[model samples]
Target: MTQTVGSRALSSPRELTRVADRSSFIYLERCIVHRDANAITAEDAEGTTHIPAATIGTLLLGPGTRITHQAMSVLGECGAAVAWVGENAVRYYAGGRALTRSSALAEAQAVAWANQRTRLDVARAMYRLRFPDEDPSGLTRRGLLGREGDRVKDCYRKNSERTGVRWRKRQYVPGDFTAGDTVNQAITAAAQCMYGITHAVVAALGCSPALGFVHSGHELSFVLDVADLYKTEIGIPLAFDIAAESDEDPGPRTRRALRDRIHQLGLLDRCVTDIKSLLLPSGTQASEITVADSDIDRVSLQSDHDQLLPSGTNYGDEAGW
Candidate 1:
């Protein structure tokens, strides 16, 4: 195998820019995921299903789900992230094995983040994506924040109008799920779900979640930045629609709706693509090759020395024997 190929999988996020999602998602419960020959398989009460780890962004393991070390290794090699959740995948407890070791993406991210102009360009690109068809030129960072806030308020009002729900503005109290209105609660639940998905994608791409362009001052600043890109389009609208319903608790419904929207939007795959675009706007950044060409030349020279002489030459027959 070529040294680059035998590294044996890509260890750099830049190399993963074009990687496609295998299944988009794999949520398993009451099952065990393990290695079956060269493939990853999940065994449950019903049967065993093959999991294409390489293309999957995240594996959600609910209550009763177990994974083997070998399977974890396979998922890591595939650059997939694992999330440990509660029953029905409602609560995210902790993260499991996520395969990534490249410093290239992280370093590139830092370089942009450290520069004022480059970071502003990235932030502007993100804003342009969020509000397409609108030019963000001549807008300062503070001006962007004001515009973003106005748009968010406008989103709530628009969703309320579309869903026939009363809009009073977004309100949520951390650690107190019931403190917020039904719409706020639903939005909170949906946002959490979105964060889980974003976290998985960010980790898989070998990027630091701590570094961010728009949002800052938090460990998950970048996660929040990516998550917010779709909230107005997905979470807010879904929450309002759920709130218009008669259920006393709409968290479950909102979550189901979010999952449906995620698939409908092809979000898992988009997440990977969007992250790459954000970190490296010009496209995938190049990673420096670690193995030296001299090493390869030395190996080729040694192979030539070890080979016996061919038998066709006049002096070769005696040496060949």
Candidate 2:
């Protein structure tokens, strides 16, 4: 049977490429993106590039990019996230879906977030992950923030010394990308890319992006939290390197450099593992998790007995009628 785009069968969670295996993200600008069967075709002045829809963790649509409805439909079916971003990824507009059918991770995140003690514990855990030598258990949220600021300052200083880039304060004016110096511009670009990548991983894991432990009041607060974990280690150094080279097109160069580094380091896999470990119970191995174990298309009804009932069955006594 011949099926139209609308009538085509969707790929199950197991059938789609795992988050770890997929490219962290594909950043496209000045191109028209449309679906050709299961592949995405990006048409630009250079040429058309064919991309497998299922192998994408996120489709980052930058400035001047237009996408068709069919492309969006296929991306959604494959559980690939789509994010609309600004040039140099400085502005993040909107995003797409959660990749899991099970509510396990989302429920776990809520449970941890809903309580003050557990929430603090999670925040401390995050800090510990970011700064292994530092103990965050005794610190209040304010103290944690202070420690983080101190470390970031040190990181900036060290990177400046390492890269020979002029040491200056991190200057970023919202809505103005050109306000900062070359280094600052690169830093902003790297940070934004990290956010986009982490957002995709968070969504793919089916966790709530709003329920954050450290960062608060934003829809992508949790995403920001996760992305910061790698900022000092990955983003700062890369940004410094980019700034050290030349001032020409810092945004694009930073994105390209960051993308290569992320793929080389397999940051996507580590991101998945880290998020799962943080949200899941203690002693749980995040690496062992898989979408198939969660069972795509599996649905159940909650009952009073603390058990799940099979869905799609009539519960009435006169069922045969």
Candidate 3:
């Protein structure tokens, strides 16, 4: 990390840009990424690009990217997610960063997930968000799955017709991208980008990505659920458009398109709002999500009757003794 004098001090959590207002994600490869004060400098054979760390929601470190510890520290402090991915950004090996140290949202998510009935309720809420015109209430998990499958098929049909792309059933092997046609390849690329973005938001919110309402059993089940919220609205349509334009370099093209669309649509802000609405209780104030100057680095110990006690104090000489 670069040390600075008077006015150029390190930024506190309160000073960092809100996750919703930041850039969706940046994909970089074959570079050395290091911190330069509040910005991260990416050095390559061509040149060095300085990116404001506070403005980035996610950093997708692709193959051949070597990031320094200082860069990682600054990203973590700025609440930016750092993901290690394979070439062409196809494989997601790991990603994490908690923008907020507070556990309120995480606890709320756990409470909702711990019960069967509430879990179903949250799942219904998620489906409702995705398909606002339809009523997913009282629908069982299997019914929801069936409904989702039908909706996705309908979406594919609609996009194919609108884009004049040949419509076939969605097909692609898990690890094999070449097995799919041009459209499928584009869709896969778009979906991967969506996952990366959603995963970053999930981590930034300090919520467990494994605890999903509709999707389950996988580590990124919740991420999948959130990403699907905009599949029809963003991913599917964009993928079709890419396929219609050209069959070459579908991955990179799709990624660039997705990033631009995300920014233009202000999807990051909407995503943050939707996740909070899904995990937090009804009518929860938006102020609860904001980080205040005093809240930064504040730690407290849980006590009896839901009270919190300040740390670094000796309670042994108190009434109990």
For each of the candidates, give the backbone clash count.
1, 0, 0
Q: lDDT values of the candidates?
A: 0.70, 0.85, 0.85
TM-score of 3: 0.91
**Model 2 spans > 4 angstroms off:** 1-11, 285-291, 294-296, 314-321
Poorest lDDT segment (10 consecutive residues) of candidate 3: 1-10
Report the C-alpha lDDT of model 2 over 1-321, residue by residue, as the tens digit: 333433335566665637888888788889999998887889999998888787888788888999999999878877788878776545555566667666778888999999999999999999999999998878998999999999999999999999899977989988889999999999999998888888888888888889999999999999999999999999999999999999989999998998899999999989988888888888766544453554547678787667788999887774453
Model 2 clash tally?
A: 0
Query: What would the per-residue lDDT of candidate 3 be over residues 1-321, giving only the tens digit for each residue?
Result: 443322356666665637788889899999999988888989999998888888887788877999999988878778787778765536555665687767788889999999999999999998899899999988999999999899989999999999999988798788787788888988998898888889888988888999999888999999999999999889999999999999998888998999999989999889989998988888888578554445556678888899999988888888964
Alpha carbon lDDT at 83, candidate 2: 79
Clashing pairs in 2: none
Query: What lDDT score goes with residue 304 in model 2?
Result: 68
The digit string of per-residue lDDT tens for model 1 on 1-321 reads 122222244333333333344444456778999975445788988997775556566677767988899988767666666777654224443343333344456667888899999889888888988889678888999999999888889898888888888877677766667777888888887887788778777776567888889999988888888989898888888888889886576766776677778888888777766766777647354433111212121111111555654333555354553
